[model samples]
Target: MKRQIIASINHNLGRAIALLDVIDSKTYQDTSIGPYYSSIGSHIRHTLDFFDCIISGLDTNDIDLTARKRDEVISTDKDAAKDHIYKIQETLTSYTDVNTDYLIHVTDNMGQGKITVNYTLESILAHANSHAIHHYATIGYMLEQLGVSIKIPGFGYNPTTPVNKREGI
Candidate 1:
C-alpha cells in the first residue's frame, strides 16, 4: 500500500515535471487565463505546499495545512517548482520503511474554524494525492486556455475517472 501510494504521487509529479519541461516561463507564470486568473506555476506551488507540510510535520506527527511557504519563486519559476517537486519525491522515497498505519494529527480549516483531527499516515498521503490531482485539473484548464499542449497522458485526472468523460470523447 505504501509503495502504491508513493508511486501514484511520483507519477503525477513526473507529469508536472514533463509539462514544465515543455512550457516556457511565460506560459508557466501567465495569470491572464480564466476568471480566477491563477497561473500554472501557482497551482504547482500550491499542490507542492501540501506535500511540504506533510513532510515537515512527519517527525512531529502534527501536520498543519495552513503553514504553506507560498514562495514567490516557486509560484513563478518552473525550475524552482521542479526543484521543490524533486525534494518532495526524495523525501517520499525515504518513507519506504515507515509504518503507514501510524496515527498523526492534522489541522486544517474547512471554511469554518480550524480543527484538528486524527489521521493515519497513509490516509493523509492519499488525501494529499487526491488534492494534487484536483489542482492539476485546474492547471489543465489554464493550460488549455493558454494554448499550451501537454503530451502527458491522464495528466490531471483521477485514476478512477473515465478517460472518455475527461476528454469529452
Candidate 2:
C-alpha cells in the first residue's frame, strides 16, 4: 500500500513537471482565467505546500495543514515551482521506511475554528494525493483557457474517472 501510494504521488508530480516544461513563465503566472482569477502557479504552489506540511511534520508527528509557505516566487516562477516539486519528490523518496498505519495529529481549519484530528499517515497521504489531482484539474481548466495544449495523459484526472469522460468522447 505504501509503495502504491508513493508511486501514485510521484506519477502525479511528474505530470506537473511535464507541464512546467512546456508552459512559458507568462502562462504559469497567468491569472486572467476566471471568477477567482487564480494563476496556475498559485494552484501548484498550494498543492505542494500541503505536501510540504506533511513532509515537515513527519518527524514531529504533528502535521499542521494551515502552516503553508505561500511563497510568491513559487507562485510566479515556473522554474521555481518545478524545483519545489522536484524537492518534494526527492524528500518523499527518502522516506522508504515510513509506517503507513502510524497515527499522527493533523491540524486544519474545516470551518468555524481550527481543529486537530488523528489520522493515519496513509490516510493523510491519500488525501493529499486526491487534493493534488483536484488542483491539477483546476490547472487544466486554466491551461485550456490560456490556449495551452497539454498532452500529458491523465495529467488532471482521477484514476477512477472513465476514459471517455476524460476525453469527452
Clashes per prediction? Answer: 0, 0
> What digit string (tens of lDDT, one per residue) describes model 1 on residues 1-169?
8878898888888888988998899989899986988888999999999999999998898899989889989999899999989999999988977776667999999889889999987889899999988988888888877777776788788888886765510
Could you report the Cα RMSD, in angstroms, for every candidate shown?
1.8, 1.7
Query: In model 2, which residue pairs have backbone atoms overlapping below 3 Å?
Result: none
Candidate 1 Cα errors over 4 Å, as ranges: 166-169
Tens digits of per-residue lDDT for model 2, 50-119: 9999998988998999999899999998888889998998888776575556789999999878899999
TM-scores of all models? Answer: 0.94, 0.94
| lDDT (CA) per prediction | 0.87, 0.87
- On a 0 to 1 TM-score scale, where does candidate 2 land against the true structure? 0.94
